[model samples]
Target chain A: MGKIFDFQFMIEIIPSILKGIPFTIMIAVVGFAVGIVIGLFGALFKIYKVPVLNKLTGLYVSFVRGTPLVVQILLIYYAFPILIKLINFKFGTKIDISWIPAVVFMFIAYSLNAGAYLTESIRASILAVDKGQMEAAESVGMTMWQAMIRIVLPQAAKISLPVFANFFIGLLKDTSLAFTAAVPEIMGQAKIQAGRASRFFEAYIDAALIYWGLCIILERIVAFIEKRNKESA
Target chain B: MSNVMIEMNNIHKKFGNNHVLKGVDLTVNEGETVALLGSSGSGKSTLLRCINLLETPDAGDVRINDYSFTASKINKHVKLEARRRTAMVFQNFGLFANKTALENVTEALITVRKKSKSEAIEIGRKYLDKVGLLEQANQYPSTLSGGQKQRVAISRALALDPKIILFDEPTSALDPELVGEVQRVIRKVAEEKVTMLIVTHEMDFARDVADKVAFMSEGQIIETATPSEFFTNPKNERTQKFLERYLQRFSYSI
Candidate 1:
């Protein structure tokens, strides 16, 4: 809709951007999966106040959340290999790092970002579950871990579903930063197409529309799942 | 002598500066129904929770059936084994909100007891039926009435076949009309001679179901007596006063 934006050029590059959609989606999904594992451990440590690790988790979450996502992407992309090398050098280990994909680095960075935000969500949701639920499970002879996994986490998950959905949507948009790493996600495709045509605004608009459409589709699927879950629950 | 099912000796618990259970002791024999009565803040619930090590008493000796350990010396396996020997029915029902009534009843049976799913379901059904909730087994806790939820919880407890069942003010959270239904289920359980230790404000239910009623005040058991003798002829002045204050409105009902 902006002046000097060529509608024709936007339509032409939309196909190119569409090709990058899979990369965008793949990273988001992989990031989300990795993020859940990190978030659960971080949240549990924070909840239990597990000595020194809890303090470290607090600092990790604060640092990740306080900084910009793009900075994290660039910092991890450039600096992680150096840190890995230092660890290998000191430990006398020959962990091969060269074979890792560029997108794997994106996965690591984005997951850490998503994990920090999700740690808070998971902690709040777990706390929000009724105390009695844990007691009831333990009362019936469950170990604490069994009670948490069986009784408490399910209820907590239901409470945190909306937050999870919002985070996933946010993660999709955050995938735009992956373009900085030369990962051919939606925004990466747009950047390449716009650079070729020298028409940045139109390509970005096309990419934006695709993201909007994907989000809408994701939201619909979530709504439908929620409805089915409600019926069963 | 009858088998001793649960024994708490010199149990001591503190919440920072607040001392809730102060060197308290009680014994529940097999097939005994001991009703614990106390005014609020008397530490009756805390004492019940100590039986399962739910509160992790600062100091005490707990012996639940074959597992015995000083509270401070307990390891995870002994603690869990002792817990496995007893089940608690909480005042708020405490039904797993995510599980159906049947699942709640079968959870420990399948997971802790290592029973087959079909076997657990069959056992779960029997207990659900015992509580007159066989039809509601598929329903979630949120959908059931408070009475139904508590009944499902009772079935859950019964399904474990625990050495003892601990009730922490089981009917206190129910609506007045709903109280009778759960009380009926508990009464039925008591009639079967299942070992039980219940904390309750219901003086009449205590008198009706408990073989002995123990009075607790300020983190100590003041006097324990047979239901008839305790209700009609309380020997302790503190207990007499507590009963007088708590029973004023229900004086004629008592």
Candidate 2:
């Protein structure tokens, strides 16, 4: 308790944690952006039931959603190396993978998790759009795909924005899991500093505070978007 | 004149166990306004939907302009061409809620016809002005009242400039006072020589604007005639019973 307010210790560690902010932000932004792509494809596949692809997409979504995200991150970072090696033997080429591989793996895992949820949200919103709208678009010389893209998706997107934003913030928090891959994100750096200086309590507290602050800001932004959407609607 | 702008041959549709349209046949000449009148579930709306391929007929041929669309035998190209020439307006004003009224009107022009944005907007504004919704051009669907939304929907259909426009109970969703505004818009379009197929309950509007009226019942068109003949001297007993029942329900003089 007496060591909790070690001002000099906190001052020294602040810069180290701040240095990791870029990685933290990168994981969140990239993961979420990729997640949206996955979500859009997942949604399209599920809604249209495109031959064999729809079943494959369902399998992927179910697998991703059924597994815990933390286990997924670990398997992607660790077990994936052995899988790649096996594939490399089959292809007869030694594949040169980099740290980028780990980042991409993390992105895939987080994106897929968010995508499963987003797909459900998008599908529901799309179903809620009146069926007459589709008939009207079709009658006006627009093909089925044209009606989906130009008419149905736009209205469905407005309905889905709030849920999408919430998923984005969840993806941000999930970035902390990337540290297991030795990615040196904010949480990783804080843990490293705490280990070296024997200040685990102080370092972890600061990390939790930063995460809470980010969540608050994201919530505000989501609220603003929802309000604007309602007013426009 | 072309033999027919639209020809429906033995159209039949069923939903689950219920028969909606049963062995119905109809035809519309070029530049004609045909009103389909019936009690609910009497197949008026289902017939209109079938004509546009919105509701696939369980059995029938829907010939529009030069293309023939049959639910069982339609090829992709035939379906495409049939859809391209026909336009429909719905009872609930199915405007895309996210887009401005003008954008909703212009979406097909740009997406399907490959018109430039500026060109589509120009065409959109023309049709919107035609429907008397020019002032509401930039407004979203949520901003408009029921009648205004229907007007915008009318403009959207008109923007395609299709060979014919089908209205499925166009004024049914509007307020009692607001129904006349949408009806007037439809009347104005009809006066401009636009070919139309309307399913409606507005007996007065049907009488005044329709070149022909088809009365449907129990999944069949029981009778069809010029509005005066249909109203004053309906031949089918079912048609007379329906008109009498409708007049009684609405408490209006027929």
Q: DockQ numbers for every candidate?
A: 0.82, 0.73
RMSD list, candidates in order: 2.6, 2.3
Q: Which candidate is the best by TM-score?
A: 1
> What TM-score does chain A of model 2 get?
0.89
Candidate 2 Cα errors over 4 Å, as ranges: A1-4, A96-101, A227-233, B1-3, B250-254
lDDT string, candidate 1, A1-233, tens digits: 35576888889888899999998998899889899889999999999999998999999999999999999999989897898899899999887778777898999998999889899999999999999888888888888899999999988988888889989999999999998988999999999999997898888889989999999999998898788878988
The reply for model 1, stretches above 4 Å from the true place, is A1-5, A80-100, B251-254
Please provide, for model 2 over B1-254, each residue's C-alpha lDDT reduced to its tens digit, 9 standing for 90 to 100: 65588899999999999999889999998889999998888988888877767777899888887777677976556666777888888888878776899999888888878899999999999999998889988898888999999998888888888878999899988889999899899999999878899999889999999999998889998898999999999999988887788778778643
Number of clashing residue pairs in every model?
Answer: 0, 0
**Which 10 residues in a row give candidate 2 chain A its minimum summed lDDT?**
A96-105
When summed lDDT is taken over every stretch of 10 residues in candidate 1 chain B, the lowest stretch is B245-254
lDDT of 2 at B97: 72
Residue pairs in collision within model 2? none
Isolated chain A TM-score, each model = 0.92, 0.89
Interface RMSD of 1: 0.8
